[model samples]
Target: AFTVDVKSVANKQIPCHPEQKMLDAFLRRGEWIPNSCNQGTCGTCKVKVLSGTVAHPPTPDSVLSYQEQEEGFVLTCQSVPTSDVVIAVPAADKPSSTGHLLRDMTATVLQMQTTATDTLTISVGIDEPLEFSAGQYVELAIPGTNDVRQYSMANPPSQSNVLEFHIRRQPGGLATDAWIFDSLTAGDAINLTGPWGDFVYDDDDDETGMILLAGGTGLAPLKSIALHALTVNPQREIHLYHGVRRSADLYDVEFWESLARNYSGVRYVPCVSREHWSGRTGYVGDAMLADFDSCRNYSGYLCGPPAMVDAGVKAFKRKRMSARRIRREKYTPAP
Candidate 1:
């Protein structure tokens, strides 16, 4: 095994097999760097190779240009070490004593239900204790293959061992149609690696009110955030809006209503776009524009399709909200 050196890490040296990805080796040793998408599509895991050789795989020119590759920059997620190497971790990824480390877990499917017209609510029980921020996600391994899919945790982090996810059906998705929907069942064992993401609420940002906007199953992470936020400060005013094409496509309305019933500061608004209903009917961004004239002291958390997230950001900006206070995660259908 070759030794990989991370300049930012105090350990200085870590073992890495020739066939293993550098990031996987680092994470296995409790060393973490700033990362979002682990598939190399997002350049969040890119780092400067101070001194080392790696078998870098083909990546999108848009994400890792040839010029950058020549300059010893590589996406650690896909780069495999060839020999002893030294890499510079990004400055933002300061090691945290209390942060959750990447874990490989074997879980038994505890429950599964169709939460909406195209969404499935799944619960899996892991034998080991898991710790994660409220709005983080996990990667589910596809049996008999190396493929893995990312899904946000729907349940709050307090429910650590048993993770919940709201998965939307992608008509031709291998993970959904072929595996999760077609074959997965209660009691089935599955492999997963997790506790990834940065779109979470923290007490440090408790000064502003919250505007949680979600589209379709994007409500998962926001639900976790809201639940944790209320736990930290119940009286913190929160406006949560879920936008879907029709009422049938909506799920968890009752859950949100229950939160509102118990917590006086919780406001749940269900929005229907293509169907007429006795409730709010329009795009989520438009609904937010109608509800709040000025989001001066409000923090926005939006998740969904890219268009919806972009529109939500635009609406929030229009309401005089600052860009730094807006957090969003975009979901793309598996291809």
Candidate 2:
């Protein structure tokens, strides 16, 4: 065992087992580091190691670059302590959460349906109701294995007991092909660990407008955020964009279209990237660029594959939007 010292508002130390990742060790002790895509792909769980050593895999050049690794930066999700370590946590030390923290619970599958798109919508009822912010995700533990797959909740915080998830069927995916799409069925009990992630919508921000950009099924968290935003922040303008290969890949068109029609400040645009369409036909970032001359007045929220998120960020910055006003969640495929 190694003692991991976490520093932010105050310095606190906890014991970390050699086999355990730093994130699992710290979160177990109620230390929530702002993180998304815990697979070491998004770099959101990165923390500077001020002292000592940790064993971590070589993350992609895009995430923890060689320069960052040389600067003692490590993804807490992938780092395993080899010696007592002191880490600099940038965010304030939060004591778990104000609401219900995460726990291992048995969840029973309630419903599963195929939508207009290739995605699958799964609704499961948990043994206990967990209070979570919109845009947070849950990990589904594979039976008889240590592996778990993460999926963002499609439901808002209001639906605490009945957790909903939108999953894009990956044919070769272990969780999807071998388990979820193949063998999983309604009434089947599965182990769940959640409500995790920090990619939540900031309803309290003074920004009068916000932009939501999503690719494929990356709309999961954004859907939750949109529902929460419309419910709580009625006055703010919400411009949502969902980018897919073709119109066939787009789901929930009616629901989003209805929201735009009913809510005066809401605007939803579904963009197609791979096809030549009469409507918006381009990459998600390009679609955003075409509609808005400048993004300086709005807060931007992007969720998608890393490439899509990167493109959106570049577009927003080029449009005079400050980098601080832009937030993103990257859905990394399970490796």
Q: Residue by residue across 277-300, what tens digits does model 1's lDDT show? A: 899999999999998989988999
Show where candidate 1 strays beyond 4 Å.
9-11, 65-67, 93-98
Query: What is the TM-score (0 to 1) of candidate 2?
Result: 0.87
lDDT (Cα atoms) of all candidates against the true structure: 0.86, 0.84
> TM-scores of all models?
0.93, 0.87
Judge candidate 2 at residue 92 and give its lDDT: 40
In candidate 1, residue 192 scores what lDDT? 91
lDDT of 2 at 109: 94
Tens digit per residue, CA lDDT, model 2, 250-323: 88888899989889989989999889876688888998898899888888889998899999999999999987
Off by over 4 Å in 2: 9-11, 50-53, 58-62, 65-72, 82-84, 90-100, 276-279
